[model samples]
Target: MTRKIGTEEAIKRWNRFADAYAANHTELGDIHKEVFLNPAIFSLIDTVKNKRVLDAGCGEGYFSRLLAKAGAAVTAVDYSPRMIDIAKERTPDDLPIEYRHGNCEDLNMLEDKSFDLIISNMVMQDLADYEKAFQEMHRLLTDRGCFIFSILHPCFITPESGWEKSKDGKKLHWNVDQYFYEGTYEQKLGERENMLFFHRTLTSYMNTLMKTGFMLEGIIEPKPSEEMLKKYPSFEEDFRCPDFIVFKLKKR
Candidate 1:
């Protein structure tokens, strides 16, 4: 049986790996974000100008900065103190953003229905209590407000999923297993540090959103655009299978 990790352990691992994780992120985020998530996320939302935006689980706050630059009033929050500090330091003096230390499961500091839109990039999987996080997000958004998040594709990125590589180290088919297992699992993020991620099936995610009173707006299995593929040819491998999934939900 896979041992279930608590939220505190998850946060501790995040705090420890925060610096190394942030190192890979630029203003556009890592290669995966640059190629897949950003496009899918931005496509779902309309204009951000003069909107109230919440960057839930906003790591180093790159997306928050982007939203601020685009004329949104941005409030960014992260569970890790180190991440919050890095976000503040990385944020320029001009971009108006509020950085808060808080967990996505319970953001009581921010009032209910306080946001026009909430964007959580590559964050949901890292959370241990995703159901609570969903409820919190529902509470945070105004009526008709949107909540957009990206996570690892639940069906494909399972605990026992990886490449079935050949002996010569040549490319091979992607393998997936244990799709029904839903709990915390440690995944290597850096050379030594292992990060915790909670895996739930796609049905669970969809049903949870419905139960939380979020109307399903849209879903995207992010694929690198032609422009992105031109810039990063290696991402052509993404055509074989999707690595990420983005969802747009409206608070109803």
Candidate 2:
């Protein structure tokens, strides 16, 4: 049986792996973000100039810094204290950003209807209670405010899914199983640490957002653009399957 882990345990693992994680991230947030997520996310949203933005689960705060540079009044939140510290260190003193240590599931420190837009880059899957996090995002947004987020494609990146390589280690098809299993699972992040992630079905995610009073605006199964493939030739393999999904929702 897979051992159940709570939010506290998850945060502890994030704290331990914070430095290693931050080491790989730049202003664009690692290679994956640069190749896939950033394009998808930026394509969905309007101008950030003078917009009040919240970066939920702002790991290392690269996205927050990007928002600030793009002329948004950005507030970044991360549950890991070490991660917040690293984010602060990376951020230049000139970039006006508020780095707060808070969990996405419970952000009472931020008032209701406080933000015009909230972008949670690759965050929802890490939380133990994503439903509550969605509710909190809803509460934080002004009327008709936009909430954009990205996560590993729940249908493809489940606990029982991976590559099925050949004998000579040639790439083969991706395998997916146990799609209905929704709970905590251990996933190795780097060479040493195994991070905790909660899994949910695609239907569960959609239904939860609908129940939280969010109007689904758009969805993107990120595929590397031709420009990205030219820079990172290895990303051509992404054509075989989507590794991530982005969603744009609005509070109604």
lDDT of 2: 0.94
* Residue 204 displacement (Å), model 1: 0.5
The TM-score that candidate 2 achieves is: 0.98
Worst 10 residues of 1 by lDDT: 1-10
lDDT of candidate 1 over 1-252, digit per residue (tens): 255677888899899888998999999988898889888999998999999999999999989998999999999999999999999999999999999999999899999999999999988988888999999999999999999999999999999899998999977999999899999787888776788889999999999999999998899999988999899999999999999999999999
> Which lDDT tens digits does candidate 2 get at residues 1-252?
154787889899999999999999877899999999999999998989999999999999999988999999999999999999999999999998999999999999999999999999988988989999999999999999999999999989999899999999988999998889999988889666788989999999999999999999999999999999899999899999999999999999
- What TM-score fits each model? 0.98, 0.98
Which pairs, if any, clash in model 1? Answer: none
lDDT of 1: 0.92
Q: Residue 100 in candidate 2 has what lDDT?
A: 98
Any runs in candidate 1 off by more than 4 Å, and if so which?
none
